[model samples]
Target: MTIRTAFKSMSVAELTRKLASAETASLLLALVEMTGDTAPLDRWGKWIQGPTPINAEFPTAEAEEIRAQVADLLIERGAQTERLSEDSERFRALTAAATDRVIPDAEKPLVLKEMGLLDEAFVDWSAVRPDRADQFPVVIIGAGMSGIATAIHLERMGIPFVVLDKNDEVGGTWLVNTYPGCGVDIASHYFSFSFAPKSDWSRYYAKQPEILAYLKDIVRTFGIGEKIEFRTTVQSVSYEEATQEWVLEIRTGDGPARTMRAKVVVSGVGALSTPSVPELPGRGEFRGKVCHSAEWDPTIDVTGKKVVLVGNGASANQIGPAIAPDVERLTVLQRSPQWVNGVTGYLDSVPEDEKWVLSNIPAYERWFRVRTMLSMNDVMRPAATVDKNWDGPEGTINEANEKLRERLIGYMRSELGERQDLLDQMVPDFPPMMKRMLRDNGWCRMFRRPTVELVTGAASRFTENGIVDEHGREHEADIIIFATGFTAARMLSSYEVVGRDGVSIRDVWGEEDPRAYLGLTVTGFPNLFILYGPNTNIGVGGSIFFQAEAQSTCIARLIRDMIERGASSAEVRQDVFEDYNRRLDQEMETLIWSLPVGTTWYRNSKGRVTANMPWTSADYWNMTRSTSLDDFVVRYHDDERGTAHADDIYRELDSDVARTH
Candidate 1:
């Protein structure tokens, strides 16, 4: 029933068995918290040497011994003490000892908050009465991960809101991308929401079904399902400046489109929602069941069929290997090679014993999450930064970048073993992190299969039976699957967003190059927020869930501020929005993606880095930790403040600036 009661029921033998499978460092820190003893840290501190999850310097025997000691200590004193205290100094010391890295004073607060040791500052919903909150109705688009996260925050704040998704169910991307071998590249713990950590993930990197199940569980647990209107698509959102509300045109399951009103609108229809199927010459000529990876038709069987997979990005890496054994011939067409890092246990299921520790241990799950967060949070950022002085190869950015390149090459060589031809095709000419870094899912090994072939050319045209390459070589295929990623640069390309003065978001952003102040708000948009928007995608480190939570918190806080201040609308100041994007572009010039690396979705048609945030996760966290009222021009209701307008306030501020100058 209760966590403490459940944890107390575990015997010493069971605890020891489970602990043996757990990370030694996580166990040690959790033990310290559970037992109020620092003895385990002194004993095992030397064994932890790096920031990664694989930082255990001890041998297998020694690790088992440490687990045994921790189990005994937990059985002896864990139940008696309800976690020692919220001791920050002790936490900082224990974290350092556990991670074996110096936790900087500046970064400790963020680290603490991520670790669940410190709670993030949320709006005191009690400050705004329920009746007042109801006046500010919110409408969220897409019942995906970001949408679900935003809804949870609103639900917690007791704000009246409804989630609209085109799909029949939740789990936006996960629900849509049902291709074989669809799964997460990041570790299961890190990919999930920090607040709703799943202790019993089936695999180290969970597949689609499990991921979807997890999201559905969260919806049920938080009671977010009833508030969600599934099979409902938001066609357009137009801001009503006169009434300070958003007018939404939505369609439910082929029904007649209807209009609704909301005080605020949040766009969670992420960049990855729309599949980017390239328009090749003679695409209609192909006489086969062609499908994009995202819109995979499950009924179409690939067994004994010659399959042509276009694009060797994250999705193709998984799909190629998964179908290689079953398909008669698996031809992977590549425009350019992606930098893939080999992760140990990429396909390994989480051991039952390990799950036991995560589920039952007092502070083990939190510490384990912290370990993963610390390990992944900007670990490869140094490799992504350009070092202009040091001269290396064309692909290498800096010393760290070159080192990563060499290490990855070594991994490919090892995996391909004697297959020099395959290794040559696998390595990319651009620097690491220029494109999304993929996790090795037997992609290198799949090439060794007799039935599999890696074609190093783009599709020139589609024949009646197959596709012709750039060199005019035809590859016969019974089925063609486009693993060609999504329209990521074009944010909110699905629906129309009409902001102030009837200016369309599409008109402002064009085909791509969407910019938002802090990737949450735009200058013309009032009481509107974007989650997983422009420049919010984590390129080198962190997950989208992290960005979503931070952005949701920021939006929630801003809405709360509006409710408390009795404001009709809150729009980001033009100067603030322009200044933020200017700084973002300036920072983008220093990142690896800005270099003339071959075409990547991270960059827009204008050759600007539009998809990824130039800053580290911690940097973004600090920037969005709180909303600055000064950055936005808040417009009060006509009754609250007679005839005061946002435009009038901006002009007055501009006049004051002119006089000061």
Candidate 2:
């Protein structure tokens, strides 16, 4: 049954029971949206208070009273009402109550868009579409979350597009990374797209298989599977100024290389595709099997075999605990300690009643998503901000960061009761939010196991049947798993991109330190867009899916504007690009990632924070919400070069709409 049908058919008693399992703040918000009643907010607003208001604990009697009121309101007024409240005042009030903070007037639109209440990303192609729009087709690389989102936008706009993937299936990283204990550290609700939400996720934090299944289901639901060219690798993309097209060289499954052309190219190939294994001496001499975490070989069983894992990062934190019980001996080589937060239900599944509320209630899922977005995105941002006047001891960046460090240390001490040795090895010497925070998935408890050992040092070399550490100590092993992460500093390193004036992107970006305007377009690359590009990775707050959506929306608007103006190509001005990067660098200095913390992939070799975005997700969203032609140098098919005024183009499109109707 449809959600509307399910919601209408729900009985009061059943709804009350399901609402009892739902988050109080989200339940109240959903009820207010459905019934246009702000009474519940005043009644239960005091109970909703915290960074994560959804997790707020209320008195037992008061909680039941709130649920009963919500049920009565839903049955009496919400089910009968067709038009919900669209008032700005009501929206601001509801959002403030749910988030436990004031929602500024300027930020209300962004918040509404995040709650899935507004469809700002939609473009009216019928009125603004150029006569030759059909001639300009788009080519999107990598059929992952970003590529799929871009394709869906193009499909809705009635634009011609093709999706290419190097794998045989969708889910780029999810399809490849099948290591043991592989799962998302972020909440499942926040990790999903706002447009296409999955309310029935099995776990609060989903695993690889389930997340991959969700992506595949999205592909099928949107009919995007037919438009994907699987097993096709784009080797290089060269822009041709003569024809105003991008020539893509691709190869398919051992097939000969072929050429294809498109008016626009969107690089959805994210920073984490290629694996980065450290160059250790005598690695070939080791007799044991070696494999990176991304390239896991399931057939190679570690049952009762000695295993030595390298690089105790995010993947290692999960992999060590997962394989500790099955393996005879597990040794983890750590270069530095990471700050891992202990989550209560890190491995627990979502309850059935909660899923029912999410699936059956009218606006419960949206409100729940909004709460998660607020809690996970910007609420924790203060802890990552640098304070130059901080007087705290070493390892802390600011007062907020020091408080977080203390809480994390207290949790670690409690987990490792008498094992101070392990606790010492696990406690990081840097701030809490410097690196990506990992969720505790039995990582601390695994250290208490007799068979598991934590080696504190880097691997210097490898022997015939063992690995040697920096201190010249050898650890025997039958298998060597490199949890060493990806080459995140190098954006789009898998393929070559030659832009205007025969300038290679590699030459411009060098080995690392990629700079982009709004993390979307480059200076010399005309009609090219990059999703999840440099300075786009979230270090402390927000979800990658949200970033992907923001970028895809901006790209769609740019393409739409190009067609509306009858422009052959559009490139960001060199001055605009440099100015953006200059501001981004200044902002970077205020973030924790720019501090001299332990070694992290967030920073490049030049000590610049190249991978992480310094702005809040809402800030980036507002910045990319619209495109201005004044920022780019536009050229027509007849070789006429000039920038079009946004006002003139909009007026012309409005006139066209009036004439057509």
Candidate 3:
């Protein structure tokens, strides 16, 4: 039996004894977080209340054991998990400045001693350029993490910026996905921004409520909410060549339209916002209630209903196992198979004692988080490169691909004992990491349930009652779920912004592909910035927070430089943007995402892989550290008409909107 199964069956004393083993501690914690009675997750309510006070301390031996276990896991992964040398004077200088961002003073002594923080080296962007300080008014679209993060850095620089969001709420993706098992695959320790860490996360992998609350808290704590205009969708932006300003038209919630102008426009409307429902026949004829996973219906009754889930991407990977038990009959429609990596459990709440230690011990949790960032976040980016010799059936590369295959295959054998047919149907022919790997430690086990059915080779064409799969089989489902992913390559789909001589952005790129220099600004579009833009998605496995933070820092520096230079606009030189994209395309030629053999959403019809980036998060971070005028065309102007990026974007709502009767 799996350790998880044994954990579920253990008694209170027996469980505590099992948890005493450092190897099983995280597993036991996962079990408790999911099913424990000592502390309930829902009871914590909303909002980040700041660092959890460590009322009690663990025995030194026990605490050290936990740290050792984490280290072992990193070693097992063959990651760049080694720390900076403590004896190095250079390391001390870096750490001293990074203290505010990465180190916790209370936990520093023990943490630094064990983790070797002082001697460890870091590239402090703050140090590289003290002359890099520049400021400008900035316009940011989309009020998600990417937008808020940009605002955070701008605020620290005392630079003014505003964020415009079409949605009524601030927590972009988190605000939409309310599924049962919806949470992060990456550990929360590494998932957050280093400058504003949340030491009080209830679970290692934080759930939706906790993450949403964190975003809300950041907004409140940083006073970022004051910079956002809610329920305002940006519809077409235009640039005046004579004035060098962006005139953006915004539609209010009640339908009143107005124009706002800014020095630069940045779009943060993330890739996954617009979901792609497959172009299948009779899709409109599903009589009963149906919705995409992103647009989950909280009030809709899935209980005792015949449910059908299509596509096994990240969304399907999560929802399939979660709703299997609650519904009467559940069918997962698979067109193509995907390799699922071993479920790293982190959905549970953090233990009160551990939470306390994390908050009180200065360097302890912060150092641990840095390790988690390197191990869980940055480590796996390289394996995404396709090996030419990997001419196998398809899938993952190197040792990573092999180990993941073994873990998942073992899980399958354990889950489906008597039915080899079911196991084969569930398994994929490809190697791991070729595409994204999903985590559902509970998935295979849930397959054992009699109520669930895994339908393989379901090349679906929507039918009246439900779906008609390839083998002429008709599955009648009360509800249909279109987890068909999203339109990822088509960046900035909405606003038709005319820049510099009435050149519309759509006319410049067409439907073929969207290209940007460092995924921030376009050549023709001067002073326009994008967060989580085209070719910026972590083509490999990494924390989105890291990418967002990096992009935020990049843009913040750009604004700072403009203010200091007193420049009106800095547009990417055409040749510079083209050369950068050429090298980028060359780098992508060897990546798995460029595979022409597979039918992946990563590739567009034109054979351009515009959605995913080929480099590591660290590499991207180093590239975006600062803005150089050599990379752009710096426009000089001393006119009263010139404005900052955010000035004309957001506006305050009426007293009635804030009023409660």
* Candidate with maximal lDDT: 2
Regions of model 3 farther than 4 Å from truth: 1-136, 389-400, 458-464, 638-661
Q: Which digits, one per residue and each the tens of the lDDT, describe model 3 over residues 211-306?
A: 999998889988889889998999888877677778889987988899888887888887777877767777677677778888888877788999
Q: CA RMSD for every model?
A: 4.2, 2.5, 12.2
Model 1 gets an lDDT of 0.82
Error of 3 at 572 (Å): 1.2
lDDT tens digits, residues 1-661, model 1?
1244444567878777777788877877776766666776777778788756667657777778778777676666563334333455567567677575786766767766665545673445533353578799999998999889889988988889999999999999989989999999878887887777788898988999999999999999989999999899888999987798999999999799999999999999988889989888888888998999999998889999999999999999989888999999998889888888898788999998888778766487877887788778888899999898969887898999999999999988888865777887789888888888889999888888888888999888899999988888999999999998898988988899999899999888887979999998898888889989899888887877788788888888778766655567888988889999999999999888898768888898878888899988888888997456667888866754643433454443434332431
TM-score of each: 0.94, 0.95, 0.77
lDDT of each: 0.82, 0.83, 0.65
Over 4 Å off in model 2, which ranges?
Answer: 1-14, 51-55, 74-86, 126-129, 640-661
Error of 3 at 360 (Å): 1.0
| Candidate 3 least-lDDT 10 residues | 44-53
Candidate 1 stretches with Cα past 4 Å from truth are 1-11, 60-62, 79-87, 126-130, 639-661
The window of 10 residues in a row where model 2 has the poorest summed lDDT is 77-86
* Residue 125, candidate 2: alpha-carbon lDDT: 62
Task: Candidate 2: give the clashing pairs.
Answer: none
Which candidate order results from sorting by lDDT in descending order? 2, 1, 3
